[model samples]
Target: MRIFTGVILLTLSTTSAFADCGTLNAPTDQQLSSKAYQLQYRMEPDGLAVSQDFSVLFEVCKSDGTAVEGTPSVDAYMPMHGHGMNYRAQVEKLGDGKFRATGFMFHMPGKWQFKFDINEPQGSEQLTADHMVK
Candidate 1:
């Protein structure tokens, strides 16, 4: 009987820990994931425009849905052209795993890759999402 009670308590504690990690409020435009993390992002002002500056709002969460700690960085690059954006994006933390990156421009792009670099104490990882501009 004592062993059964201990097992029940252990199970409850583990379940509650994961329950605290909730999913993102709404669906995002794009999502990228690795073995340990998941990133959900959406471009500000809805759609992409050529040669126009915009912002990207994103959030990084652990595989268990818990918000990740540490600051992350964002960047854009054109693999085919071998060049990146003229301006560098400024990243801001909005708490609870949320972040916003501003000053992004696609400047005559065909295929652009949005890079999200997650730098945490555990390790560092890069996740990329592809977008096409008309």
Candidate 2:
């Protein structure tokens, strides 16, 4: 019926809208390396936005370039602005050194430093990446 057809169209449009956001994973985008581990991360929706909920997907690897098992904690702040994000991102371990952080929202756009504190049997290390949000 017409209602069914309309629903189908609405579903398609919603799917396409998400698709247009693009995949945030890019090897060359943002990365950090330390004596403990190396981290590569990307922000969902391609670029960072102001006052919008976003997700950060990251892969953590050992110094020897192997996936690690650890606990990840996420935090963000603007050093220049002397303030941090109003929202706190929660980290979920996805196994194989992969994690997904959700509930992140930058109240305003600027140079916000994203940091991941990872803890493992060996010890803990902090990795940070600075992003310029418009």
Top lDDT hit: 1
Where is the poorest 10-residue window by lDDT in model 1?
A: 17-26
Please report how far candidate 1 places residue 77 from its true position, in Å.
0.2
Instruction: Point to the candidate with the largest TM-score.
Output: 1
lDDT string, candidate 1, 1-134, tens digits = 99999999977865554445434443544867676787878888778989887999888887666788987999999999999999999999999988889999888859999989998888999999888999
Error of 2 at 8 (Å): 58
Give the Å error, residue 2, model 2: 77
lDDT score, candidate 2, position 115? 79
* lDDT (tens digit, per residue) of candidate 2 on 51-125: 878998888777654577766898998999898888778888887677899989998878999978888888988
The pairs that clash in candidate 2 are none
List the candidate 1 regions with Cα displacement exceeding 4 Å: 1-29
Q: State residue 53's C-alpha deviation in candidate 1, in Å.
A: 1.5
Evaluate all candidate structures by whole-model CA lDDT and list the values in order.
0.82, 0.77
Residue 63 displacement in candidate 1 (angstroms): 1.7
